[model samples]
Target: MAFLPTTREEMLQQGYEQVDFVYVSGDAYVDHPSFGCAIITRVLQAYGYSCAILAQPDWHNDDEFTQFGEPRLGFLVSAGNIDSMVNHYSVNKRRRDKDYYSDEGVMGKRPDRPTIVYTQILKRLYPHKPVMIGGIEASLRRLSHYDYWDDKVRRSILMDSQADLLMYGMGENTIVEVADALASGLEAKDICYIRGTVWKTKSIEYVSDYIMLPSYEEVCKDKRTYAKSFHIQHENIDAIAAKVLVEPYDGWYVVQNQPPLPLTQEEMDFTYSLPYERTYHPKYKYIPAIEEVQFSIVSNRGCFGSCAFCAITHHQGRVISTRSKESIVEEAKRITEMPNFKGYIHDVGGPTANFSREACDKQREFGACKSRECLFPKPCNNLIVDHSRYLDILRAVRELPRVKKVFIRSGIRYDYLMYDKNDEFFDELVQHHISGQLKVAPEHISAEVLDKMGKPRKELYLKFVEKFKQKNEQFHKDQYIVPYLMSSHPGCDLNGAIELACYLKKIHHTPKQVQDFYPTPGTPATCMYYTGLDPKTMKPVYVARTHEEKAMQRALMQFTYPQNYDLVYKALKTAGRMDLVGNGPKCLIPYQKPGHFPSRRDQGKRYGQKPYAKKGNERKGMKKR
Candidate 1:
């Protein structure tokens, strides 16, 4: 299949006078299933709607926004695959030097908060046209969210963008429904009842079976109220059990309907089977982001491992959805046929590689337990920990012609793998899938921090490490395990940092880089960071808020660096850990020489010199002595 029309010429060539929908994106046009824009547009095309691409329009002026003209149906806007703020800035709020999604890896292709900016431009250019926003930037910010960059509780994107509608989460079903409704002569405001969407209204009288959340004013003023509102939003994410949620702001209400139902196997297959060019437009020399996923196949979606820092549960839901084996193999065969086909397939996994099925049987019928987690502290007894189907799919793909090796780069939940009674999949994974080092995220070593982060205890990770080593030894392979660690998370202090350092020292592993816990929007960790309390329990939690304190904690994780010597020394001293300030093997840093320089304790005792002596006077006094 040919690439979609990205310009008016192409649109005319496709035998269309006016397109049905013009999809505006923050990232450069890449027709890959991994991209949300591609999937949503293709789904619409499958339903016989003409869609044109407006990838990374120049946001400074209204001219670029009118390139595609007004579409017959509406405008679908997305802030690329990632949030614009995250793409443009680093966790430290520094402007990023490069953007992988842009052509030739250039930065500033799209403005910060592209969804709002683009929609505002569209509304200005064509006042009567309906504008809708989706993708990660809009999905996670669909409701009142804590904006880390702004350092304030901000209203929903719907309020800021003034778009008629906002579709959150995987928007295939929702977008199609929206298009069909609009194509059938329904105004955007009149089509507000679709699931997996957020729409604004002047009143809540029309909303039924809905829960009224704390208003935007309440959430902004009170952290406890925000937590309560977030909790309600969290609980109502499931399609089977969720109810409409209404949040009021300045006499207007933003209503979030229940999430769409999880896609069945056939539905997943159909979506993946859509004709994707599987590469970026030829206009650009290359897109760095496509390199990471061109050879990768996403066999599944959603994650059951609900880590506190992760937003998968909020966006993808907890239920696992898988594509058919035939569909996966066909895609692999197609990959082998590509001109740049190498003997290797980069990855065959999704959010959590091993999660091929729902966490338990009851999850499909009643939705995931709101208060409890599927894999945290310990695996639920009702969890159906199996990977046979996944193993079969991998084996089939590996046997295909021209396929040399298949790797699982997407993270595998080590805790879930450890819970399975059968070790067949584990053995195969170690034997064939691993690429030199298997990376697992054991975020912290302190049990207190782990519990607060909703991660398993340190012992579980250790056991997994032991098992991984044994398996490598059994297979006679010299493979290693790389544990991803984090610092300065809630419930972690100077002592916890010291504890993690000690653990790393015990293992004789010095990580080159440490991840400072970034408190992004719509995650439990972010909530804790902003409120200093766990939303799950509403109990007070310790948070490292100061820059110096956070820096010290991060430096301790990599204490071997020469530049970190002073920070480590100060941190140890401040924590009254003078025992760790010597030249001993266990000491993090060496003590400074006594009387080596002017100090508080050695001010007047240095060679019996006067305290106020100038440099020349000190030298003369030394000569006289």
Candidate 2:
């Protein structure tokens, strides 16, 4: 009904002498289900526990740590919704100008690696109290893994933060189990049997039947050993099929239990139905984080589409956990009642919007296959391709009173949509869901790059595009696909970048923004980025690590931009791809005169548009902007 206590006065106002947990967050408090901090605190409260929020406390002052006094149980720490290093810096390791999660989109509201920093501060102030770290930052770094910002292998966060326990993955189940244990007077060190947690131990006498990973020293000294360790971690991400994994570190051992089971439909519904303020704390001037999610609904959790660049598979697991259609409709009703409601629902999807059900029947009972993926390389033969339920959910929300439209704003798995024999979902998606454009991620057109990225082949994307155009025509609507593209990913060289540029030139669409591969922890692609070897196959992979090469790769994705012409030209020349630099229709750019640069006029000429002609929002095939 109200936001959790954020100060001692608020804590007293709630009539709590001592709270059960003090939730420390790197982000300004936004009590929405979209944020991990809000969900954890709200879940604890729903389970008859009192909790307080310590949002972005100044790390320098000891008074900030003692503001709420001490919790009855312990402290729960998270580095906001994203990793702090990632939130603070771009892929080029440049400091970002803004932090959307902070008030007024300010920067420097929190320190780098705040999960470790905050927990360390908490430990220094309250050394005896347990400090548990979670969120994307802690979850991905729960073991000995590569730290891109540090450019070296770092120990588990539990070891660095000196936190008694670390929770990985979606922590609804894990948090509650740990809370009960703590309230019952069990020490943090004694509570290790719970799933979805990483704990440190000095002896293996109590640990049994666990996979022993290469020692931390070995992985640090050898990239090949690190790749091998990453492969072991990747295979054990499944909940039902994974075994406990132990990594030795000198005199101590870090043990990671198998991931928690995916939430069932009922549990997911209950979690979302918690009493949430659904906005940032009232005292802040403005919180930029609310704009995207205030009117949206999270219809599901978890992703089965295991893209190599994505950390969702490792953090949320490969199992799909979706809410019931009724639950989604209820949330849609809530959105319509908000004062700022514009009769338009911004989103009604999660990790992969169209992944509204389990990939196969055996997954829920037996977990996903350890060695294979559901839709990469090829769709599993046992994969179930149906979207009727998701379509039905969309229809119900669309037909609700005061709701003019409902959009699936999240990433849609085009390959999954194309695989469905029934076109009902696809038809309705084009006709009803799209707000003039639908965003899909093809990532790249190069076969080797796509294979390395664990994405389906370009043929699948081309087919999906053809079908999308047909559906738009059939429905008599103008809709375009906004393909999300990435550059400088491992296994991508100058030739591969040129190949993608040619494909974009052939399609007559240039993305306004292109993501340079960010080597964040826990992703298979990051493993390749750090080790220059594929963990899955142990094959050597090409990595563009230099600033100039990364810039060229990114420029190739936006090759038509006047600003990127020099970089694109350099990339073409470097790749010995001068054949694509001529004044031909297929050439990405015209041959340059010494000191002469192409303008928007030349770009239009290449697209066969008249100079100074107005390029309106034309939904022909897939115009990305």
Candidate 3:
């Protein structure tokens, strides 16, 4: 199986007069199953659709888009695996210097909003061609969303891009349906009844049994309405029982069909079994993104741990799907045979590593509970917290020939692990999977903040930490637990920040980096950030919106650093906790350090310099200025 044709010449050489679908992607062509572009195109190929890759095309001109002339069927567009804006900039909106997905890790290969930009270019170049958008950027923004960069509510990407159809969530199922529909000569707009798709309609007369969200005008005018709209969207994400959602904007309505059903284990296995070249196209000497996932194997998809800040629930759904152990081991064997085989497998995990099964049997039939969470506050009684199957898969992978270490880099939900009564998997994880350190996200220590973030209580995390340490001691391994911390989350006020700092000090752990809360679209936390109201309860919530306040919260997380001295001191003072500014061991900073630079409190004035002293001495030695 050769790599997909990336150029028109290659397509012609492959004996195709015109490809069925010209897939435009923001990433360089990497024919690996881990890349969504590879998965979709390969799936289409398996079904006998001729697809060619048009990756990282020039956004400024239509010439690049028309390189393949026009697809016989339609154009499939995606902003790669990640959202283009996130790929291009940091949380602080600073332009990133490197794009791991691009050829040779170069930056600026694609436009800021590649999905919209590329679709617009296609529409302009071939006015009547069907443009279909999918992937992370389109999936999460399938409805009205708050744009962090723009600091305002923006219409759905489908609306902005004028894409004929928007395939949300995992596109394997949706894309096939779309292709079949288009192949049968049904127009794109008329192919609206398919599951896991969003399409525009001029009239709502045809929409029935669907929940109507607040109009775009209403949501934009009233924060409460926006919160209500988000709550409705969040509740009905299940495939079993979710109703179709309709969001109106001006005269047109964006109708989101029910989510696609969770893929069966056999389907998952077959998807990964596709013939992928498993590396970048030969044109590129290197692609940094492949390095991270080349040795890794994804054994599962979906997550039951619906964290508030995470968009997985909205995008991947909460249903867990796992491939057969045989399928995974087969993949691992192929990985060991690679030319650059290093006798190590990077990871065999997914959205949540230990979530290898559905949360409960009812989830598959009755769907997830609308009002309650599966693992927040505490695990639901119906939660099936088991790790035996996951452990079995890991053991099989470890037993593979030429495999030295199989680390679980994809994070495990510690609270979910704690829910399991069995300790065999936990012990094995400590003894085997961990490299030097195991990372877990105990986002915040404050119970209130954790509740707001939809994370487990602080005590749950503390218990897990204690158990992890005990297992490490029993195994005689000096592995450390690196806790991932977040700052300035919706409910994290100055007090919450101080409490978190105190906890970190008690644990004697200084994180190398701290993540300030970013309110990206399609998350509950983002809703709170935008509306200052918890959609679930409609209660007022505190949000750290100002740059100064967010900075202070971040600095408090790393108060031990000398450079953070001033910010910590100011935060302590502002919070009416100046008591924490003394030289006491309990204090975050010393009163003497008035600024980031050194100073002497005994002087009762500025230290390290005297105004005009150097100039005065120089004047004494020379003529006056």
For TM-score, the strongest prediction is 3
Q: Which stretches of candidate 2 lie over 4 Å from their true place?
A: 593-625
Clashes in predicted model 1: 0
User: Global CA lDDT of candidate 1, please?
Assistant: 0.89
Which number leads on lDDT? Answer: 2
lDDT of 1 by residue, 282-322 (tens): 88898999998999999999887888888888899999889
Model 1 worst lDDT window (10 residues) = 616-625
TM-score for candidate 3, residues paired by index: 0.95
lDDT of each: 0.89, 0.91, 0.90
Query: How accurate locally is residue 232 in candidate 3, as Cα lDDT from 0 to 100?
Result: 96
lDDT per residue (tens digit) for residues 1-625 in model 2? 8788899999999899999999999999998999999999989998999999999999999899898888889999999999899899998889999999999999999999999899989998898999998999999999999999889999989999999999999999999999999999999999999999999999989899899999999999999999999999999999999999999998999999999999999999999999888889997999998998998999888899999999999999999999998888888888788888999999999999999899999999999998899998999999999999889899999999999988889889999999999999988888888999889999999999999999999999999999899988888998899899999989999989988988998889999888999999999999999999999999999999899999999998888877788898888878888778778888887666335666867754544456554548642332232
Worst 10 residues of 3 by lDDT: 599-608
Against the hidden true structure, what lDDT does model 2 obtain? 0.91
Model 3, runs deviating above 4 Å: 594-625
> Would you estimate the TM-scores of all the predictions?
0.95, 0.95, 0.95
